[model samples]
Target: MTTTTQERPTGTTTEHVDVLIVGAGISGIGAAHHLKERFPGRSFVILDALDARGGTWWTHRYPGVRSDSDLFTFGYRFKPWRGASIATSEEILSYLDEVIADDGLAERIRYRHRVTTASWSSAEHRWTVEGTREDTGESVRLTTDFLWMCQGYYDHDRPYRPQWPGLDRFGGAVVHPQQWPADLETTGKRVVVIGSGATAATLVPALADTAAHVTMLQRSPTFFFARPKTHELAETLRALDVPDDWTHEILRRAYIAEGDEITRMSFEQPDELRELLIESMRPQLPEGFDIDKHFNPSYRPWQQRLALLPDGDMFTAIREGKASVVTDTVDTFTETGIRTSSGEELAADVVVTATGFDLSVFGGVSFAVDGQPVDFPSRVTWRGLMISGVPNMAYVFGYFRASWTLRADLVSEFVCRLLARMQERGATTVVPTLRPQDADMPLRPWAVPENFNSGYVMRSADRMFKQGDREPWIHLREYAEERTALPALDLDDDSLVYR
Candidate 1:
């Protein structure tokens, strides 16, 4: 919230920083905390595109949005999650603010600063990051010894949209969920929600309560189930005199293990579990409702993300005639309404395009070395954190398995170890190995992409690391196991050699 407003020196090496964090989100903020704790004398600055500091938690100001996971595991290890399970977006933001206040990170953050392009300087052994301020249009360039990219995978510029054949001709108001117009009222209006993912599922039920009529349209279905909002064992463990942190770690592991088992057994033993899932839903569906159309997904479990509800009921809303799910593709957006492949034109006054997000390579920002473009795609992942060829840069990637904060926590802790290692060996820079492009690489769209930007990651597959058998990266799902496997506190990994 505060900064040293001295003019940055131009055409010369100005401020000297030990590390430059390119985000003010949970990951970047967490990284800064770790760095300060490990090396108090080291100078580091956390930059964010928006004026706020919570990153994605700051950007997504949508309604009915809350942590799908528990707050205990979703929050940072350095900070305790004092709230109950499944915190609202506002609660999460307030908690983030508290984290900032408690850690004295206000002065360390630079707001309204969006990084444009980052190029490394091989001669000076530093990264030259460029970003412009949204308010005054002033630009700031900073060179640092190390770079930490926690900006996430989505791009806010171009909202993710599928090739809806007639989007330009849609007469009714069409809105992407990412940029949901604040003032637009859906009250008593016929609203159609596209997609069956978390966004669509959550939006449909939430909107149905207010809208005159609500319909959820999806080309493919998801294995939807109502989940318990609270965990009894977790509650018991917390009250059993177990360390809050230890209980958090254990519960995190149990949840991850449970999800992994469910997913693993689905693929490893599909018929039995699939039947159980179907049996549970069959009794709840309405008489005229088709379960196969909305609940049956084309892909197997874990291929696409699953929707969660604590109350064990999203179907009740549909059963009550408040909402309806249609498993048909939106053939086109005609003048009057959305035309489905079944030739059914659902009349609507407003359309909520909860289609998905545009996947970008780290917030649609580019990287470079010595002012030259940093071709980061030509590298293989090392421990899913560092690349073999890129030096002194680490990316916090939380793919489908676990909660995002989990890996971000690990990355933050590992960054602390990395800084200590650099100091111990007297190394000015740490670069991961950037190998030549692998000809045989099978690119899969595994991680959630933020925007629809053209990038190598969009054209890739899950080569990073799997989460044993779950959604986000499998290995880092459990905090306890992750604590043991991540970067050593002493920076003792032999794989990390100082140049």
Candidate 2:
């Protein structure tokens, strides 16, 4: 996979390759492996905006930063995860490093090359991608036969922080979990964490170890799944001297099956499932605690992701009087603490806003097709992999209810298969088009609120691509269904117009 650079008349250098991948994170690295394994002759290069690899893992350095999803499923399908079920960010990054080194993917990656724009030319039958080097701040241009977008769907630089009145008057230091300060001291300090998602759950227990007291202030409650860090099946398999590969596969399948059942119960028996989840936490918490006020969520289980509390550590911290929970809205930020709507002033020295992040479409890269600016929301998705009318391009949007890597691996295989088909037909360009039957198909938001309504997804609904109400056009959130459906898709179908 050789790349050639030629000087342009404008005094800029342009690199050319058969495929240009837009990220070097988990998805991008997985895509690279697939390309090398199947299409070894194709020239490809990976461009990433970050200074290093491990997109989210590298960016987030907050206390107790870890994977909410189990590592067995979160890890790439091709690689075996021998670590604990719930892995820290460092462990995950180490695993990713091994994959890059073993597959020789490090050289193919260009870190700090932030893509700014991408333009597709029908006449030239190629895409011209433009960006700047973060290290040198110089413009970089590249052209490719196929553009693969593996950038994950969140803004790493900016976090979604809601404005509260009198925040400017707050005397203590305020921070967001996304951009945790390295030198910030929490030892023996009163800390108040905002939001009740996975980040807050992970932070409370971790901060409580050093902080005088850690309080989790939330606008509402979120469901949490508490279990031991190590999987029982994994231990059993290891005790039986099972091979790492076999154990990985077995545990992966076992978790997926269990998750599928829980997902099904969330819809079919929501009330029962909700009670069971709340009951599971009852025993973990102190006796006579107000579980209903703090643990009960309004939405059904699996409506959004359930935060995993390994070994019920957070509850243990609360029981030990090191941390506590507050279910109320923030009235305003006081000089030394936050004032809640219930007329309670929660004193704190440092505030950590775990209020989540903003979604980024295509890494916020401006795109144009044949000189016309691409309006993503106006276009429809093709099997949730490619957009209709976008030629020679594919993006990875993972499943909301499952481990994100599951969909990433599936998309890589589908893209490879599609590329192979195009090669066999000697086609230079292949674009998703609306077939005769799809002309009148009702278009819906990429993710319907009824199916999965996470805050980020709902907030970015207007900017997301549309999904059709039919097969090969809608985004299937079910991994089990997509595992079979995506591979069985007929590349010769009229929906994909190749020339």
Candidate 3:
């Protein structure tokens, strides 16, 4: 590959490349695979802030960390997940490592490279990217024809922790799920896990094994679903001697179809579906357990991401008296525990703020056009991948309703196809710009509030780009629809300005 070096007064090292991918996690690795397979002639580099691969998996090391979604869909479409359907964090990281080694992606990855700013130059038909090395504290610059953002939406540096009165007075060690300390001890301690989402759900069961007593403190209840660790389809296929790839496709399609059916059912007959879910889980809990109080959610299914308990592990722990759930708001933190809004006091040796995530768009990287800062919220989203005014750039944002990698893999394939089209036409730039006719289209929230009620997403709604009401612009959440539309999307569409 041909390269050029540019010198500047700021003492930053600069290099020219064809593509710059901003992440080394599942998305970036998959994107690199697509690039190498589909467009080998182009030179690209994967930059990661951390010194290692597995973006979120590498950072989050809390107990009982695992994927809520099944691995058949969460795993890359090209790669067959030959392990359990619900995989652990370590297992997921190992899968990523295997992919990296098998695909020889390690050669192209630049670790500890944190992207700080990206400025697009229309005249030059490239982006001037600036980043810092987390290890060496050296500034580096790269000018590339295209910028691919697979950095994900959540901020790893900050976890969403709500302000609690008298928190400082609490003598016990307080922790957040994001920055789990390696040396922290939980064995034989009374741990209080605050939050009702997936993290809290996973932690309570796992912590109960070692902790003297584990309490799940929740302000509101969330709908929970328990799935077996193994999939029957996978087992049957393996027994039938089906090829890994073939079995993967069969299972992937089946899982997608099932999820689609559930989504439809939840929207169509919410009450019936809610009752069915409650009844299904009722048998797993102890008799006379308050199903309506602790298991039922106010919002309909799929309103927020559903919590998945692998192999009914959480319920089993609860029934065994190793764990318990407390439904009440925290009025204040006492010296040794918490005071509840219901005038109840709970004693604890440790408190875990499993609050949630601090959401970010474009991974908190500032974008500029021709030296002018770009206002992300002012721009409309183009097909959930690219911002309308952003040129030659695309973000790999996965679906909340389905496996994240399903959408990510599709985005990679679509980008490669689009790049090929651009190369064939000898075009240097392609930007998704709203046509004059698209002015009056109704603007929709990135995540429609009625459908999604996640705290992090709702809190950062104003900072995200809006989606349109029509096709080619509307960000569809269904993998079935996107899988068809994205691969077959027209490169010469009026919404896309190709040069």
Candidate 4:
């Protein structure tokens, strides 16, 4: 939320700006636009650690790196994605490029400028943001009334490769999915994909047709399901030859509604959702495949990430004998390949380690309040945007299953409202207290979170910005709920302490 104090504390100078946004991801871009609407005259800038914009999308230039969520919900609210329901990586990249260019925000975003640390000064009523240019190793700093961190969670934009026991024993070239070598060859080689999350699921299927044999190794079973490719509502609209924008909105709304409906059933007891998923999956299995052990997951639906189709998804690859799932943890890495707990050594020429991403807070930057370390993990968030203790800063988090743009769109609206209100009141800055003596706030995760994927969920819930447990504080995934919540603009903040 954009809020500044009317009184700028004595003794502050250099680059006097109203807001300083860190990270040029979608969230940061969205914040800039809203801030413009709220206070057009104020000086603001978005700094990126990398030399380009688009945050994760811009940074992650790996092979077959497309968004898992549908494109309709993924695009910004003000702007629309006028093409395919499921967009490709290149297409999504184009869309982002178009948005930035159209908005005339390319200049506002200083690429290769990364924020290293943010220290709030209560006496000065400003935040001192330190950044560096990785390429030139040049240091730059900014002091602004408010700071916003739209940088995403993944700390290691590089990849997470564990020291597998006897890993050096394997003479084969190992590759992390994050940093897939473009020039390296993987064709006709036996490939083993370690780790069983969305990344692993997408990576395995995409490689099956080319690789001699692709084996998926998992420590435990994770929920696997299909993302419906085309909806009936979308098809009908397309038959009418409606404009892409009109059809996109229709499909976006339908997907969101359907996704929320299905996701709400994610936590049902006795695993009803899991049972139904299994029942549907059983029909597609080969005649002799074990139903309970091979496919059936011990965890409930959404406990693990629901895998999507890289190329017609998991079933087609399995049915065609291009891919296989093995439920065993890796004991160690051998020169030849991986050694499983079952004492089975899989032969591999190329090993693709699709192990997950590293978790980071504020994009791996130190968060300080009044020059004191702001332990966000211990703070309860207000409206999933602002922390209770840190008054003016907002961390951008996206939806779990729904279109990330949906939540981001709402955040834009709320931030605009906050800025307008502050401007009207002549408030130059504001900071919320992270420590609430009266509130007993349980910690939570941020991102497209589901209770099912405990591994991923466990990492995100507590450290990321979270929703308030009470009515407006809770982030509602439903389309209708979000429709009302976002763009509402009226934040009743009896609890928000403004200085």
Candidate 5:
């Protein structure tokens, strides 16, 4: 592992490293830790386009921004979360800071480095990565033996904003939660938040506190699990003087088990699971609150990610008359507010669009393999870690149903193991290849719509890589299965070719 800066003739400086980890978010941090701990001889650097380490957590500053999943699983496997199950953006950032400080990862990260392109040279067995330093506006270049992408799946720069009729004619301020204004005043303001996903669920209840009235307007209903912010087991364990490490492992496994059960129920008995979820919310709402119309969704549970309403705060807001839910289509944006298709007008001074984000493939960086532009959709995923025909590269795309960090940890271990194997084989490059038996396997969309069809995913389906029907060629978003399978994977298998 070596690192040296060289002045290039083109006015850009080039540096070389053993590994180049993109995105200094949770996944990248965990990857860096694993690489340093397992292979201290290797040198690496983490590059993030943002100025901070926490990717989504750093970018999203909307009121009441918090994790939809519990911290036990959402937090890194090696780290113990001492806070409540649901953590706010500030708390999450503090936790990430601890990870960086404790692991000595702060110096290895290059913030404000936006990677623009990655060109892989098969003959050279390396990737030439090019980017610009956002702070200085200087062109930056780097070459690496391996590339690890943990930039996440969304385009942080561009949130999905639906062009509604008469949007330009609206009299008041229209704000997207992604790019929340720091100086925007909501106190005593009539706020109408659009969309029914986790963002809306989080924003409405929060804005209702100061806003004169807040309404969450949605086209359709989405599944939400109203859960307590604190975990009883975690509290009990801490009360009993259990060690943090022990508590963390126990709670992590416990949550994974519960999540696995829910996932199974979603596939095997969706209707039953759906009823259970909705019924749980019924008691929290006012009597005869029209649960069938607002709480119940047409789709089955887990088909899309479920939002977690910590302590049922959203329902409490509604019951307290501070916030309300309106299930209807927006006919158009009126001068003051919005008019529903049912001819009802919602008067608001501020409109918050909590609509979802746009999916970004490989951080929207262009890729070239042997000087030929690589088409992601034309390739297939290998165990959901590495893409076929892409050499010495692995990405972190975590579980949608469970905490994302679970798979990030797993992928870190897998990559370390693969790197060690490559060293033993004296191989400079390794890429996934189709086995003889896999040649005729049917290729499907990265995520099957029936399995998990979030709006952002459906909108970007054509840009994602394909998955095969067989082993070593599919991404089984099951943490339980991947936890065991990834570490025990046979590196000598023919699915991977080493040179």
Candidate 6:
């Protein structure tokens, strides 16, 4: 790898590196480790739009912000998460901090530097990345041989806020979970959390402890799976004097097995699964609680992502009269609180919009190939990592049904393998291209409409890449299947162009 440091008249510096990994999130940090392990000779840098390292964990510091999945499965394969099964934002951020410090990645992270546009040059076999520094608004440019997008699929700058009528007239402070204030005064305040997704589920229980009352206002219900905060397997392994890494691997596998079973049962026996979930949660509530109205969703299980309710905290809060669920539509926002369509007015000191995320593919970055804009909707995803027709680019997209890092680890491994093969063949560029028959293959939205029905996904599925029905074209969300298939995938397949 060669480095070129040039001083422009505008006081901007243009640097060249072998790889440019965007976003210093869990995926980007993992990608850095993999690159360093596999291709030590290569020079790379991680660019993050935020000033901090942990992406989502750093951004979302709201009450009860934590991972929905277990830490073992969500963590990197190379590292063992020696913490509770479900970790908080602080724990997750600290884990990432350890990863960065241990791997000497702190010096490599370009924090506050956001990449706004990426254009590929076929002749030079490089990508020209352009962006502005968040703090200074100064232009920054990076030329790299490859681009790895670990920025995630959602926009962190803004949360998805619906245009509720009379929202402006509300007397209370309206806040979104994404842009949570550090010194948010919720104590003794009647808080109304809007939406029934993961954020809402988490915020309601947490705010209930101190707030006068927490009301989860949802138009529709979401399927929630109760999980224990602790894991017996880890404790048992510790008693056996097993190494942390060994114990972590075992727990990770166990979580994967559990997730797989849940996914399978949801697809094959959705009704049975739904009923089982309802029965499990019913006992956690007080007598005469309207389970059907508050917990019952119109869609089947796994249609939308299940909110992992760790240790029945949400249920306990509701049962204790600290928090309550309001299943109704917002007719409008009253001066004091929200007025439901049923004429029930909720009075609140603060209203928290625990709404879904704004889907921003490529971190809202512009892309062009040889001066022509690369239309993402027209492209197909290859193995759920790289986009077809986009040269020397790969993204870390995790499984929706399982842990995020499980698929992230696999994608990093695949990229390393691909890099190794390229080095062996003296190849400078690699891109996934469709064969003649692939053109005939039916093109569906990246997130299949029938498979995934999450509000955030449904809102932005059309702008994303398409996935085909056949091999090398489709992206499977199954970790067990991907683990068996990804490593053995033929690098020389007609779909991939290596040169």
Candidate 3 weakest ten by summed lDDT? 471-480
> Candidate 2, residue 319: CA error in Å?
1.4
Per-residue lDDT of candidate 3, residues 181-254 (tens digit): 99989999999999989999889988999999999999989888899889988999999999999998898888
lDDT of each structure? Answer: 0.69, 0.93, 0.90, 0.70, 0.93, 0.90
TM-score of 6: 0.97
TM-scores for the candidates:
0.85, 0.98, 0.98, 0.88, 0.98, 0.97
Task: Please give, for residues 1-499, the per-residue lDDT of candidate 2 as tens digits.
Answer: 6788899998889999999999888899999999999999889999999989999999999999999889899999999999899999999999999999988988899999999999999999999999999999999999999999999999999899999999999999999999999999999999999999989989999999999999999998899889889999999999999999999999999999988888889889999999889989998899888988998888889888898899999999999999999999999999999999999999999999999987898999999999999999999998889999999999998877789899899999999999999989999999999988887899898788888888988898899889988877888569878888888889998889999
Which regions of candidate 6 fall more than 4 Å away from where they truly are? 6-12
Q: What is the clash count of model 6?
A: 0
lDDT of 4 by residue, 248-350 (tens): 7777777777777667787544377878777777667676766677667776666555766633566777777988878888888877888898999888898
Q: How high is the lDDT of residue 35 in model 6?
A: 94
lDDT of 5: 0.93
Candidate 5 stretches greater than 4 Å from native: none
Against the true structure, what is every candidate's RMSD?
A: 4.9, 1.1, 1.3, 4.1, 1.0, 1.4
Q: For all candidates, what are the clash counts?
A: 41, 0, 0, 35, 0, 0
Candidate 1 root-mean-square deviation in Å: 4.9
lDDT by residue for model 6 (1-499), tens:
5567777777768799998999999999999999998888789999999989888998888989999899999999899988889999999999999999898999889999989999999999999999989999888998999999999879898789999999999999999999999988999999999999989988989999999999999999988888889898888899899999999999998998889898898889999999998999899999999889989888889888899899989999999999999999999998999999999999999999988886888998999999999999999999898999999999988888888898889899999998888888899999999999877899988887678788898898878888988888888568768887898889988888888
Q: Sum up the clashes in candidate 2.
A: 0
Which stretches in model 2 have alpha-carbon errors above 4 Å? Answer: none
